[model samples]
Target: MKITFTLDTIDKAAEEILSQCQYKTLLFYGEMGAGKTTLIKSLTKALGITQTTGSPTFGIVNIYEGNGETIHHFDMYRLKKEEEAFDIGFEEYLTSPYWNFIEWPEKVSSLLPTNTTKINLKILDHTTRLCTIDNGSNELK
Candidate 1:
């Protein structure tokens, strides 16, 4: 699935993601300032999470509480090696039942689960973005 939208229509983009995504372990790929965090905030809102969401650039990971579930947001940009991911119990989190949204996933590509859903976001001029979704053979929910 591919979607192009402006910041003004981010909500609709988020809804399209929720409807088409096939897995909970989502790997977000984008350059800095490409609105990865912005899209994530909308996704959390769509999932019924009321709290404010932010990038976990420094903390590595941020946990958010939804109605009856948990959302694990990860920022691997600061990681220098895959071992850094394991040091933070990355495998444990990958096996969890909660939703996992990862940014800069290329930093930990080797550690990504086989069923990971890859979302690539590209800036298409200011205020506009093109998001391409690849579920990797996983069945859509």
Candidate 2:
């Protein structure tokens, strides 16, 4: 699925993505200031998470729970190597039956699962963003 949206319509974009998603793990790919974290926040809210969300740059991962669901949000930008992900029990998290939204997923690409969903975001302008979704098939849907 492809979507062009702005901050004003982010929630709807998030909803559309979730409705089309086929997996619980979402790998977010984008550059700095591309609104990856911003979109994840909207996603979590759409998933019924009531708590505030933010990037876990320093902490690596943040777990949120609400509406009978658990979400693990990961920020892998600060990781120096794939080993760092293992040190934080990243593999265990991936096996869980909860949602996993990862930012900077390229930082730990080798460690990512094969069945995950990928979301690519591009900044078209200061307020507009173009989002492309790929379900690990090497082709955008």
Q: Point to the candidate with the largest TM-score.
A: 2
TM-score of each: 0.94, 0.96
Query: What tens digits encode model 2's per-residue C-alpha lDDT throughout 1-141?
Result: 789999999999999999889999999988899999999999999999999999999999999999998999999999888789998899999999999999988888777788889899999999999998888752334
**lDDT of model number 2:** 0.92
CA lDDT of 101 in candidate 2?
95
Query: What ranges in model 1 sit over 4 Å off?
Result: 137-141
Top lDDT: which candidate number?
2
Report lDDT (CA) for all predictions: 0.89, 0.92
TM-score of the candidate numbered 2? 0.96
Positional deviation of residue 65's Cα in model 2 after best superposition, in angstroms = 0.3
lDDT of 1 by residue, 47-118 (tens): 989988998999999999968869999999999887899888989999998999999888887778779788
Report the Cα lDDT for residue 80, model 2. 81
**Which pairs of residues collide in candidate 1?**
none
